[model samples]
Target: MKGEPRLAELIASLSLATDLGLGLPQEHVLRQTVIAMRLAEAAGLDHAAQADTFYVSLLAWVGCIADSHELSRWFGDDRQIRADSYQVDKVGLPMMRLMLTHVGADAPPLRRITTIGRFLTGGFRDAVDGFVAHCQTTGDVADRLGMNARVKVALSQAFERWDGKGVPGTAGGEQIEAVMRVVQIADDAEVFCSTGGPDAAGVMLRSRRGSEFDPALVATCLAHSERIFSGLHEVDAWSLVIEACPDLDRPVRLAELDQMLEIFADYADLKSPWYLGHSRAVSALADAAAVEMSCSAADRALVRRAGLVHRLGATGVSTSIWNKPGRLSAAEQERVRQVPYFTERILSRQPTLAGIGSIAGMAFERSDGTGYPRGLRAAAIPVPARILAAAAAYQDLAEERPTRPALPFPQRRAALLADVDAGRLDAAAARAVLAAAGHAVGRRTRLVAGLTAREAEVLELLVRGLANKQIAARLSVTPRTVATHIEHVFTKTGVSTRGAAAMFALRHGLVDAGGTSAERPM
Candidate 1:
């Protein structure tokens, strides 16, 4: 793991995404990480140990999205529910009160009934299970990335409280890790500061001192409250926080990048159970489809990258809408539409990720003028965007949603083709997506260049908007191998720019069409 991308950098980027998902200002998570690191240093931890603390703080809520489906199921708006989590201690009166207030608070009569029924049927058990799962899942990802065992253990116990009333209910001073304790306080403090300023943040921390937070840390935070938060409001939070990164000397290698992306993608997917593994599946299917479509190597690569993260916006929607068992109300639908836009908002902040953002931002846009957020018709959308959009839509349709069963292969293909015929999806792009999905068209066999199944997997991720590093992790290969695959793909596809390569895939039937089918032969 030594030449890998500093865990801090990836964590920082992830924090930014988490902020967007929560509808907060960028770097909210990063700032908390910074504060946590400083607190760790202040607590006399060594540099190597501080690195562990850094990651733990940034990733404390990595599993926050995991239970979003459940949260939305009970509360309606998952993000709002999470945001409110910051306001209440997850114990006793505060916790119970918050739950009662938020449950079905803004839902319609029908939704309210459903929510009540779910709670009685098993929502309480489900919520607790979801929280425990989030901790374990996040800890597992940290372990997969080669993080310190102690950190992983701490992440697993992140929801534990000193009073033994948290998720796992294993209370004790020793049960809570030193880093987790500091980071927890820091995380809550940062949220309060961002929303209500230093005074409010201070008051919140003071109020929860012995119950939700450590008393000693609370005393320290209150003592230096002004100094800790001074000028925080004036800072360009993203830069201020990221620039303060605990300066590791090496850049992230491709393999490390892949691991981080996979972890983050999984975390993002947790926002709704319906979306679990959706990004990874889309990336794989899209890459195969790209190769089948004869897309240039660069475009195939970009499509893969886009596919890995296309649903970043889904986090912003309330779990209520996402998990509803029936059609969305007009307002709920509108909120759902804003998800793609939110994905772009988060991605736009990082220059390295801008390309992926651009493609993902158009996930909901239709070929015809009927799509939402910004209903740009055909020709108005970029070709790369068109391909990515088609893959995402087809993938979503093929999956079982709360309101609908999974579409059968024939029905799905017909529906997809209807979009093409209606001018809502580019015919060539739709064909490529279908091919990638393992569907056959009249007399046309899917195509693939000199690429292994693994290499094609890598190629599709690239097109979906993952970086070289991200591709390596998802495919379980070395960064160098991912780069080599990219180079080979470029040579075979005859294109250089990512956008151009993506266009080529759409035109050639290389993307997977969201059903079970034999992948193209290497």
Candidate 2:
């Protein structure tokens, strides 16, 4: 066992994806934690309050991904929508303006009109009130992570208002946790300050003081602006956040780690309806091929997890690109290229999760170096990466995408081999993945004993114990033809018995070695 992962590393990894989900720059959430914890200290919070604030800051948008499919449906790009969100309060006018601008964006004229109609009727209502769902989802992640009840409760209350104007409309003022107020204020401050200066962050905080924020907590944060923001400009966001985690040193149970990763896989798949089962499918194929290729147990685990999370950066890009039916614009393609690099960067931020990032980042790279994010070529990519890439490619061809239908088995095999022959995929790795995907590769396609192609086909069925009548049916030939071919097969092989013919077929590699035997010749 590699022992359990630290609580801090786990949270740091999840928060990296959460940052992308919010459409904020990487480390946005981590930086918020830094600011929030500092605000907690400056406000003279006790140890318990500081701890509560830490959990809330890292997990505030933990459920932000729950409504990604919905966001992408109404607005084209969920990430862009989230980024624009921080610019305006989700109140009357600014919210309506944003909604009006994006209702069925990029859709055809008729589709746009229909989408607008749905929005006016009841769709907009479901969206505006999704806060309760987000809260509950985040709370679920917290509970699965074995967090305390206080952390779960604070998370669910995240969208509530101080004056009772927020979602759920149930909690107000002190009904929401005091620590949550500090974290919420610091969250926006980090985003607002990045574009504006500390002065701008402070101004933004003051603007929302009473109704959206706690007046006292905001006042304390403003009072200690110098100390709170001190050295922040010099520190690395991820390192500072990980180091500051009060629970960073404790190791999580192995089973807990697996469940957490499964949750992340499910979350990644939710980014678009097109991606519904992609991460899990890729993970399963990669894991199986890793075992076939004899990766070390640790590397096997890492490869599987990396496959699950290799698309973490996908959330950073707009779903508009993902859902586009036509060709992408040059600028849009560039955004797509950044996904693997983004995944690598996010995973690298966590000290313990860094190795997995290196492996996951190469999932899209090709042997010919024509792949995106980083055009790693040939041996420049590791074996595990090659396997992951091949596994992902196999699943990609076999699965349907918005832009194309799923390739049939024959086409899938041909596509894979073509990539290998073109020097764009690792030949051995592709073979392993293809075989694992149930696309058998037959090694003996030659005419053994002068058997014709038709005869070879008949011989295979005979060896498998098919009766002459069944063989005739399978080959779509008369029983006389089947019997005549069977006699030719016996005379050519110098064998009269089915058992002897079966032995010959088995000896000639008629059965599966790895891939499906109905495989195309390489």
Candidate 3:
């Protein structure tokens, strides 16, 4: 634990969060990765193909985060949709039926009918668009993490099928990357095997062979089915994947560690469009507030890392709940409160990240024991965790939600102070966070990608899920003018979709991570 952590630990641990997001049991990805590796070995693939298969297996469905917002709109619970998707081949009428079954599942009768009508019109096209978004976002994240080109390319084809039925439908049969083919079988195999045993897994694999799965790989799986799944249920998938890390157990340096953590932050935030940049903003605010509080350098860094991952568990909850425009019912609120616990469980399995996980898990704990998951009182809450709680609160207030617009600085500040009065947040921590936000420093002066100030502003609102008319109204411009600005933004940034543009803004820090200073509040 004292030594630098290996890259495998980081990725393997993050895969746990991916499982939660996909509504699978923890270690589902790890189990699938192990299975994929076994299948790759059994197929007599070369070392390069084997290595690519290893990572592609772990990261295959991670792109699911990219289109969760759209999924939630079409299907009430994105996770449930994914969990159920394993039972069917996601192409043609079967795929369309699965989606229609879940459309507006939790909405009121009128809203549900309206949503169904919308889906009947153009929703399937939007669904295909989501797959495209997933591929690009996954490739971008792989590129940023310094994954090899083969790995990135394999990830880009994650949505493609052997039958040419996948989104983008650019590749089929042998044209699809072999590594992706391996993962396709292993991914669903793990689910079927886990639920109904290896016999069921074998049946499912053979059924989709040459269509959803590569025939050769499926044949290999059937030949070595017993060996491929041997001890899959008995062994600890996390430990197996970490020890068998194809990267030779290489450790990530401190700088690389921070960069990868930032990638995880972006991935977690991508769970919903409304959450775009939320983790980054909270991280920036927490780091700055820790400085204002006179914390030690190590503590400052710890809080910042914690802030970035504090919402990792947020993936466990459905966007239908997170995106709710009105007050939550008692049952819904209870489920949301478990987010921090999920975060802690995801990170705690990785030895080096466990400490950071503990701090992040306390992001919702209140000073007076009113907050959730643990509800520790003031004396038990450490200073850094307290600052994290306050930083997260402040950033949330500053961000636009479906229920309300971004709070003005004065109102946001007053809200924080009011939390202090209500004994929910630390008084000192709230003051430090307010001061840090009011006097935010070291923002990038020159915009990258040649975006004008207004273009950057439009990009921010666009990422926040605002329509052209809403953005125009907010900026006091016509919808056509906003459209022009958006087109310019897309051209300059080299991205054609709002999801990709949001990634650009977040990666380049063009959008405000926190509030701007109108006054130097103490």
Best by lDDT: 3
Q: Per-residue lDDT tens digits of candidate 2, residues 1-522?
A: 464667777777888888888888778888889999999988888898898788889998877766665566688777777788776656667777888778888789999999999888976776765565577567656866778888888887888877787887789898998878888888888888787878888888788888788888888988999888766656897777777778424787765565567667655655554555567668778888888778898778877877887787887777667767779999999988898888888777555567877888899999998997778898799888898899888878866565777788789889999999999999988888877778334355767778898888887666444567878877789999999998998888765544345334433544321222221110
Q: Please, what are the lDDT tens digits per residue for candidate 1 over residues 98-190? A: 876778877788887777776757866766776775675566556656677777877877888766678787765656888888888888888
Pick by lDDT: 2 or 3, better one: 3
TM-score, one value per model: 0.76, 0.79, 0.93
Off by over 4 Å in 1: 1-7, 20-26, 106-125, 247-250, 254-259, 377-380, 439-522
Ranking by lDDT: 3, 2, 1
Output the number of the TM-score-best candidate: 3
Cα lDDT, model 3, residue 215: 91
Among residues 3 or more apart in sequence or in different chains, the pairs in candidate 3 whose N, CA or C atoms overlap within 3 Å are none
lDDT of 2 at 445: 74
Candidate 3 lDDT for residue 358: 92
lDDT of model 2 at position 454: 88
Ranking by TM-score: 3, 2, 1
| Regions more than 4 Å wrong, model 2 | 1-4, 104-118, 247-249, 253-256, 439-522
For candidate 2, the 10 contiguous residues with the lowest summed lDDT are 513-522
What TM-score does candidate 1 get on C-alpha atoms?
0.76
lDDT of 3 by residue, 1-522 (tens): 355778778878878889998999989999999999999999988988988887788777777767777788789788999899999988988888988889988779899899999998988888888877777777777777678888988898887899998878889999988888889899999999999999999999988998899998999999999999988989988888877778534688765667778887887887767777789889989999999999998899889999999999988888877788888889889988999999999898766689889999999999999998998999999999999999999999987666777788899999999999999999999999999999975665358888888887888777766788888888889999999999998889877666666677778776554333111100
RMSD of 2: 16.2
Q: Which of 1 and 3 is the better model by TM-score?
A: 3
- Clash statistics: count for each candidate: 54, 4, 0
